[model samples]
Structures are given as structure tokens and as C-alpha cells.
Target: MSKGWWAVVAVAAATAACAKVEAPAASDAWIRLAAVPGRPAAGYFTLHGGRADTKLVGVSVASVPRVELHLSRMTVGDMMTMDATPAVDLPAGAALPFAPGGRHAMLFDVPPALTPGKTATMTFRFADGQTAAAEAKVVSAGASGPE
Candidate 1:
């Protein structure tokens, strides 16, 4: 009887602790304009850490076959280039911005429905085995931001 009672108490405490935990969120998340049958798309947003420092290591979305982190940069010769990045450090309370010509996520094999005015869900994977989810608005091809 005592063993049974202890098991119940432990389960209750674990559930309560998990309920109070909050996951990181993306602020102003949006994807660049891409039409159906399009090659791929890019997502831009801001991530702010809470409680402790974390690292953003990966991203996934059902709408796209594959999603990964990337960085847009200019080479010494003055040509622009985009490359895959492993991860980005996110210090607590600090905002990590992903925008044009900067750090962003590349979504490959996107679905045609991810056009402007449409909403899609994106999941960000952190190094700590925790994940954060966000909804991204597909911005117009010519638009700079979600306007």
C-alpha cells in the first residue's frame, strides 16, 4: 500500500513541474513568398531565450520536406552566398534575429499552399531536447516583412 501511494505522489509532482515550464517562441515569424511547386522557401524570425541560455540547433515543418539553419553572407570578392549553419547561441533574455541577408532557415520541398496570407506551423529544435513551436505567415515575394 505504501509503495502504491508513493508512486502516485511522484507522478503528481512531475506533472505539476512540467506544467509550469515554458518553451521558447519565435517573434514575428514569417516565410518568404513562395508559390506551390516552388523550389524552396526561407523563414525569418526572432528567438528570445528564457530562464537559461540555450542553442537553436534545428527546425522542422510538416509543410516542407526538409528545413535547416542557414546564414547569408558576403564573400571577400563581394559576392553573396548562403550556407548552412550548425547552431546559434541564445543567451537568456537576448533576442536572436533572423532576417534578409542574415541568419535564417531554409525550407526545402515546400508545399504550394505556403503563399502570402497563408499560415503554416514551424517547430524549432533546441540543443537541450526541448522544442518551441511557432506559426509563420507567408509573406509576399516582394514584401520585406509581414505587412
Candidate 2:
């Protein structure tokens, strides 16, 4: 093999290595619906992070006029209360689970007929200024997944 040919091969290999594609910041994210009627609804999902650290800044859906990041906390009075969370951190290769009675998405002003078997398309904004969309299926009350 010639020196020039070996140099070409090295450069080609380096280029290929550097061209490796990265996975998305969030994956396998989904939401489950609550069965209760007439009241504000809650959404649960998982946020999967890629190589870079990210944070869930906000979420939006046409089905709801407002979505807020909320955390259920135990107060000094020993009563459980919900408070708005600024952002949900996403560490590399980690999945953050949003579940009922815990860290969940509070969906306000939802459509009147948001029922089971229907899906709500929600777009999530990340701290890196990228957006990802996920479909959340309406489920019966007390349902859970990772299933």
C-alpha cells in the first residue's frame, strides 16, 4: 500500500467516525390519561435523554389550552400539595418518569370530551431549544405503564 493511499484511508475512517449520528434527546415518551370527569386532567409520561443533558421546559397541546409542570409535594402541614415546577431535568441516558401523585403534567382547559381511546398530540419544548412531539392516549383512571 502506498503512503498516499494509507493517508486517504485514515482520513476516510476519521470522517466516518465523526459523522456518527446522535439519538434524539427524548424517546419512548408517552402519556396516560385520568378517568375522572369534568375536572382538570393529568398526564404522565417518560422523558428519555440522549448524550447531552436536557430539560423539559414546557408542553403544549391543542386539546388543552394550558399545560403546567407540577410536582406533588408533602408540605410541613403533612398535607400533599401541588406546585409548579420550572423545568424537569434530563440527564444523559436517563429516563424521567412523570406519574400520578408525583411529578406530572397538569393539563388545564382540556376539551370537554377527552375520553378513552382518543389521543392528544403534545409537543414538548426542551432546554436546548429543540421540540419533540408525543401522542398521549387516554386511559382509565389509575392506569400505569413502562408496560
Candidate 3:
């Protein structure tokens, strides 16, 4: 092959290698306020994985005080319960949903300003040092999750 053609091929390979991959992202985030005041609210969202696998280590809410990852499951007695989880797996090119009766986030110490129709900033931390933040809509306790 000609030298000039070889140079062009090398540059093309380099460009493809240097292409940037999209980072993990969070979307459709929303919070459902507790039925009673002073209780923890439920947070739901959709997490889109990046080009690599990672784990969701933690979550933080700008308007709330504390947030914890949780997994809900039904016991042998046909009763449902939720327990705190340290991390949740985030596979590459997958969409993980934090919805009702499954994995979710427990937001504590939510303020009055995060009432219905309001939005709050929620940041998600990943084990790979990647972080994602999204504005979560606030919904009333009696209402279902995001439409």
C-alpha cells in the first residue's frame, strides 16, 4: 500500500479509538411523598448504563436530608418488606428501573418545599466514580408514580 494511504488508515483507526462513550445517566426521576409527614418518601427513576458495567453505590437528594438504597421483596408469609442495600448492579447498556414493589430509594427528612408539582435535584453515585444528577418530580402520596 502507498505511504499516504497507510497514514490515512492509521488516522482513521485512531479517531475511532478516541471516540468518547456516553456516560451513565438517570431519567424519569420522581418522588412520592409519604402519606404522613415526617416519614421517608419513595424515590423512583430509570438508570441507563454506560459502555461499561458498574454498581450504584449511593444516592443523595439536595432537598432531603438522607437517602438510602432499598430492595423490596415478599416474604414466605406473603408479606412485603423492604431492606437497605449497599449497592445495586448496573449492567452495561441496560436500563434499571427504580419503581414500586421493587428496588427504590428511601428519601428521609424531606422538606415542605418538595410538595406536589415541585422538583428536587437527586444525585446518583457509582462505583466507577461516575455520577449522574437529575431533577425529580414530587408527587402526592395518594398518586401513583410518574406517568
Q: Which residue runs does candidate 3 get wrong by more than 4 Å?
A: 1-18
Residue 59 displacement in candidate 2 (angstroms): 0.9
Q: List the residue pairs that clash in candidate 3.
A: none
All candidates: CA RMSD in angstroms?
6.0, 3.1, 2.7
Q: What ranking emerges by lDDT with the best candidate at the front?
A: 3, 1, 2
Root-mean-square deviation of candidate 2: 3.1
TM-score for all models, in order of appearance: 0.80, 0.76, 0.89
In the range 51-146, model 3's lDDT, one tens digit per residue, is: 999999999999678999999999999999999999999999999999999999999988888889888899999999999999998999988976
| Candidate number with the higher TM-score (1 or 3) | 3
**Where is model 1 more than 4 Å wrong at Cα?**
1-22, 34-37
- lDDT of all the models against the reference? 0.84, 0.75, 0.94
Best by TM-score: 3
Point out where model 2 deviates above 4 Å: 1-36, 142-147
The digit string of per-residue lDDT tens for model 2 on 1-147 reads: 999999999999999987874433444444555466656677777777766887889988766888899999899999999999989888877878887778888887777677666777878888888777787777655566534
lDDT of 3: 0.94
TM-score of 3: 0.89
